[model samples]
Target: MTWLIFAFLNALFESLKDVFSKKGLRYCDEYLVSWALWFFADLVLLPSLFFMPIPELNARFWWALAIGGTLNSICAVLYIKAIKLSDLSITLPIVTFTPIFLFITSPLIVGEFPSAIDFVGVMAIVTGAYFLNLKQRSLGYLAPFRALMAEKGPRLMLVVAFLWSIAANFDKVGLENSSPLFWVISLFSFISVALFPLVVYKSRNFTGKLRRGWRSLALMGLAFAIAVSCQMQAVSMTLVVQAIAIKRTSVLMGVLWGALFFKEKGITERFLGASIMILGVVVMSLF
Candidate 1:
């Protein structure tokens, strides 16, 4: 039950990180924001390594880090780009598709297959996505799905979701080979370093942008660190599925943030749709 608290906290802070990233993206390029996320998070996370005993490394750990870190670095950039290019309500809800993708990637990467009940969850996700753009249904029955495909942000986020499914399997492998804290620290550090070269290559005034947006970037990183820490702690205490289902609550929080912070329209539909999607994830994860 205590794990529930940490899981909920993970959801809250994860949403906050999205809010901050969206806000930061207003002034900063996606590259800078993406790099800043991992870099500053590492700044907050790396210090803790000194306070805890280091876990023994293994070939499996290194393999997971290499694969997951590279995939996540690309996902991070694409995620920020999605947010920058579209509304949070539109882009964030699409992330819920990750679980559906996990049904594919997990079996291939980790040799784990979901039960028959998970099919119902898949249908629910598809249905919920339809409702997300219910306002567009006047155009046609398939309009909502078409809208999702037409929107670059949602399309890119779908890619992020798919890549995340693969990375998540590696994350499990990495955590199995090392402590959660060490894995988080190592993965984040690896991503930060991986993205640094691209951030420099893509941005003309990287230092100036960082100097200007340091506060927002730092806060976003802190939120991300807290979110990941709470998630890892919760996972340590509970089933991975349970922790992840609880964490998907961030999708709902993201929709609310969209309405509140950005004053994005279609709140009633998006919120309802996100709620349904979250219920689908919970169903898949729990039963």
Candidate 2:
């Protein structure tokens, strides 16, 4: 129960982060903003390292963070690109199957075979994503599939989903095997953000935009840092698959915010799709 609560909170904050990030991305360069976010997230992580005595580091911890950070960087960049390329309604649902990627890959990566119920949940997620890609008025079941096949956002989102799945699968391994709660994240953030200066240094025309994006990116970093910490807390207390399934509710929240705040098109079908996705996640968590 406590883990569920933690997972719920994690989902909520992460949804908010997605909302704010999409808004901020409208005014910022994707790479520069992502870089700033990692930089500030590391800064937020630093103070937490002192909360308890630092423990001995292990190769697993470093490997987890390094690999997670690299993959996450790829996910972040692709996500922002998708946001720029498609309507929030379209792109978000496509990316929402990130957990599906995890579900499919978990067995391979963690060596745990999924139960029959897990397969059902994956099917539900696929159905939801399919509906989300269709036009609200089309009612044509194949329309979304046709649109996705011809579009770039779906392709980009697919790459993002795969990378995100890999990162998420390693999250638990990194958290438990790590020396300190915040140190590994801090290191990952530092290494990842170190690439931002290079990004900014390379772009002359986007300097003003980059400066403007810095503050929002920093805030995103803080939110993400907190989100990751909360996720770790949940994973430590509950089953990793259950925690991840619950966290997928963020898709519902993000789609809602996209419709209400961003005024994106195709709200009706997206809402239905989001609800189905949430239902699938809930079912996955329950049985």
lDDT of each: 0.93, 0.72
Error of 2 at 250 (Å): 1.5
**The 10-residue segment with the lowest total lDDT in model 2:** 178-187
TM-score (C-alpha) between model 2 and the true structure: 0.85
lDDT of 1 at 155: 97
TM-scores of all models? 0.98, 0.85
For all candidates, the clash counts are 0, 0
Every model's Cα RMSD, please? 1.0, 2.9
Best of the candidates, lDDT: 1
